[model samples]
Target: MSEGGSVKRSRCFPAALLAVTALGAFNAAAQEPPLIRFGRGFAAEEQVWLMSARPELTPNQGKKYQLKQILFQANPERFQAFLAGELDGGTAPGLAVIFARAQGVDMKIVASVCLEAAGREWFSTTYMVKDDGPVRSAKDLKGGTVGVVGIKTATDLWARAGLLNASVVPDKDAKIFPMGFPGMGDAVRTGKINAGTFVEPFYSAEMARGGLRKLFTAVEAVGYDHELLDIWFGEKFLKAHPDTVRAFLADYVAVTKYYLANTAQAKRDLHKAGFVRTPLEIYLKNADWKRDPAARVDVASLDKLSKFMLEKLQWLEKPVDVRQMVDESYLPRQ
Candidate 1:
């Protein structure tokens, strides 16, 4: 990617032209690092947020590889970007991973960003309904509307799975409407929608304002622990820049380690980076997303969910061999 240090020009070239061309090429090469175009969604996905916030922890950044992060409001569009060849890789939900595989995209899971384990104390996606609303659980949602980030997204999948488990058909028993996370609280509160998915900063803010009750978490809806979101790479990109990818992932894990160890400071850095805008005290009091310090992916959880989507949810056309799609070589050594 660096063009191997220097260029070799033929002896026939004029001295002045050769020097100018060589110098210009060298300077251009030096100025341009391999751009890692990736997409990121909001809140507690420290891999993207932390890496940019704490550049010192990522030694290879700007030298070996540069980042061109494209932000998305939700996960489905991010996956569309990856499949459309717009991003090298970034955080994506396990459902998106399987969906990509089903669509014949050759991408590999490189590392873990976060998990939605059932019993994990870390922050997970919470579906909220009015505390005194008529609907109480998945079973009570018949003829009601459910708001999510998008159809077939992780939130939508969980919402549908929860409904199915309760013997309520998704589209027939309850409707799903897509909207941005920022407005979910108001939608549920004003009775614009019966229930909706709420992730971080918004979740806490909405709860503090009162009038919402937790219907079920992502884990509870899906009925097990699973890889919620993970870092991934296109197969061709991984093959072309294995060292660059490895270095980026190494820094990625380092940021995770640094964040877990120094959360308050990390949050302060995030505040400074403009990722969060709350008063320092409020941001610090918010729960952090559950990230594995070692950058380990729950491939088994992915596999189980893959099977569930294929067999139970009828979301996938064929079985996805999640184990085969995983490539942990990019991660820092244990």
Candidate 2:
């Protein structure tokens, strides 16, 4: 299990354009109605539950906000929309925050929303192959094939990072094929791939199949690090309604604490958000969320992780200033 993980998005950056378009809709909607429309995507389940549940976790007050749309696009597109002023606010990957700022996108990370505190790192289930198949570890497969999701996803970054950690260069030493998570075990079992990266529910599913073996998870390979998912707002929104931003932060923090303290409610929300299929207990068995008292960007840790990704995985076009993208003033001070 490899764990881990944009700009001018088109299909390459639809999320960017979408963000701008989304924002215009919000503005128009605001003028005509009391509704506050939100363009969001699924990340951590808590966000949907807290923001919509009783006592609303968002800072929008009694204005009434609706999750207008949920797009599954990656970070770059989402931030692109924010920069274009189409989206009022949305969550994005940590790296996207830096990339958007570097490009002068006019957005800032206002609060840390979700944390992958405890979960499977990058581990694998064992798949049987013909005797000619290569052995486990990069050292054995100088020219073997492995399965990964998309090249730009966290899974890919972690896979490449894991390779670097193992002293084997991916794409140079081994070939990585793009495939969905569901196909990983099948690919390995049928010898379509040497190994595949699987996480959580998938991890437990593969394990139960009795063919896969654990390789190494993100924690085991990358250390006890955290994966941060955050809420980023357009600069325009902050300038126009700074108190609204502060209120949002307070509600966000309160909801996070509420969710952690009352997991059943959180799980119910997760189920609604479609992160888990079965009971909340099944999903919780794989992943748990963590909240920082102050959910500001962990600048130093992000820098280290970003540098590793850029140097090893060539994920970014240029280096970024983590501090500039992170504006913690909106979060309430203890």
RMSD in Å for all candidates: 6.5, 15.5
Per TM-score, the best of the predicted structures is: 1
What value does the lDDT take at residue 305 in candidate 1?
84
- Model 1 residue runs over 4 Å out of place are 1-21, 27-33
Candidate 2 contains a number of clashing pairs equal to 27
For model 2, give the 10-residue run with minimal summed lDDT: 1-10
- Model 1 TM-score relative to the real fold: 0.89
How many residue pairs collide in each prediction?
A: 0, 27
**Candidate 2 local lDDT, 1-334, one digit each (tens):** 1232123232446777789999999988776423233446543546544566444455455543334434654665665665555678777666556556656777777777655453443222222222345565546655777677666555666666666677777888877788877778778778788768775566666666666665555544455454456777777777876876776667667777777677777777767766557545566655554556466556666676677666766767787777777788988887
How well does each candidate superpose onto the true structure, as a TM-score?
Answer: 0.89, 0.74
> Per-residue CA lDDT of candidate 1, range 154-269, in tens?
88888887788789898877899988888999999899999999887888888889999999888888777778888888999999989889889888888888888998898888
Model 1: pairs clashing at backbone N, Cα or C within 3 Å: none
